[model samples]
Target: MESQPESHLLKLRKDTKENVRKIYNLDKPGRLEEAIKILQHWIQKQDHILKKDWNADYLDKTLIASKGSVEKAKKQIDRLCTMKTLIPKFFEVINVKKELPTILDLAMVMPLPTQTEEYYRVILVKIDTKEIKPEFFMMYFQYCLSVAEYIKTHDYANGFILVYDCRELNLAEVITKISTVELQQFITLLIEGYGARLKGIHIVSESKAIEMLINIVKQFLSEKVGNRIHVQRSIEDLPKVVPKGILPVEYGGNEKSIKELQEEWLEAITSEEHMEHLKVMYKACTDETRRNAGKFNEEYMGMPGSFRNLSVD
Candidate 1:
């Protein structure tokens, strides 16, 4: 018999008409309600949470990312709440007014206007190392967190396809300049707490030096995620993996240019509403009383020792 098509692996369906919850297994009509009840019980049982840091949308995102697994979503939220105090270097409060302009100038994270047939949102990362400074690293990470949060709230259950454009980058310099601890922290959160599926990572216009970069990155990521990293030697070859229609004109697609995409994202992420939401997110993380109540184990509080061991300065 011929093997099933790979597209079957990405297939999703509506779990319930009332809730609009999508999942690969649609047999459970009450999955969303059951997951929400489980999360609500966990929230009430906790001693902290002076302001109720989360809402239904937050729970929905966590549940959807966990594929309707209440146990997994609970663990995810626990890690998320504990992460801010545990990793202040990356998860602490960021002053958007002071940081947003520089972040926009140095890096552009543009989510493609359309999703793929599998409903995966495409995100393009355009970095200009020439404009980046030491302080901009954390800002860049904060911007990424903002983007992830937006997707979690707005996109329902969709995963992501990340394209890293390294066309004009000084590969060696950029890699060495990044902090190992911070990089590990970011990767840990992406894998553990972000509550969104990272479908694939596509590296385009890469240099010969990318092998070293990949080796270092794979140390922090699992074999499964490592396998998902695709290196395209030339822009012309991107369509073999990423469809041409989703790419920008420079990459043989009809979407907006990098500059236009950058400006659009800058406006979206810096709007008054988004800025306030970011501030609230930071405040929720910094609540010491709330975090103290969780009482996470030393090893489980932040980056696992195994992950730390993978970090090379």
Candidate 2:
């Protein structure tokens, strides 16, 4: 297998790495190395895990998401593999070149090139059409996971800030198409499976349907995360919460236009090198037959399909 290539779409800021090291207490002599070693050993011992050769960079990001807790990181890794195994809909077909272009045509969900002053990466999700199909939601979820996977392997950041542009959205059309059960699973995969440390969720819209949309989405979020969501009356109001300078030119910022950013990301993610990387990552799922029955039941009792009553909180 070929080694994963470095990311050309996104680059860590000059001070970002140093800042993360200090904040995560990785600056101490051998601290980060020791943590990675311990996690590596645990992975080797887990018989159910099919892909145990996770690189140091991957382990380091897992630790950062766990906030330096080794125990939490272990559980996170377990849940990640388990979720991928159980949820084939999201992990089964990751052919970016073939599957992603259609979804991109419908809506744009791309991470901005600029990181915030605090080093949190920003993701821009722009939904322009109201003619959303029921099947497209799953494709959208898959696209998100693809982006998250790309970030996991390449980018380093304190957390993620999601900027959702709903100016042209028809909430009534969108809400009916979105299944609560699927929503739960997608959020679980994003936070637990991918270790996405979400910092904020900012919705940009002027539609009266904003309230209804927020109410529905809030059900899947914890109080802490729910509180982080803010609705902007207009794009002009966005800079109040998110920096204007880092935003796309369409959003009244200095950066590239949304179209340009999206095109660049599309090309980068669909490149032959990244496609190979995704092929390897798709095999990182666990073999449930090999997993201890008791441990499996204990850890994933509340997984989406296991029970009708699901709560991400």
Worst 10 residues of 1 by lDDT: 1-10
lDDT of 2 by residue, 1-313 (tens): 1112476566567788677878878868899899999999999999999998999999998888888788888989988887777777787646665766677777897888778889888899998887888888898898888788889888888999999998888877887788888988998888877778889998888777788978887887778888988988889888887889889999889989999988888787777877888888887888877878777767788777654233322
Whole-structure CA lDDT of model 2? 0.82
Q: Report the lDDT of model 1 for residue 90.
A: 65
Candidate 2 matches the true fold with a TM-score of: 0.93
Which residue pairs clash in candidate 2? none
**TM-scores vs. true structure, each candidate:** 0.82, 0.93
Lowest summed lDDT window (length 10), candidate 2: 304-313
Show where candidate 1 strays beyond 4 Å: 1-27, 49-53, 91-98, 130-133, 286-295, 298-313
How many angstroms is residue 244 displaced in model 2 relative to the true structure, after the best TM-score fit? 1.2
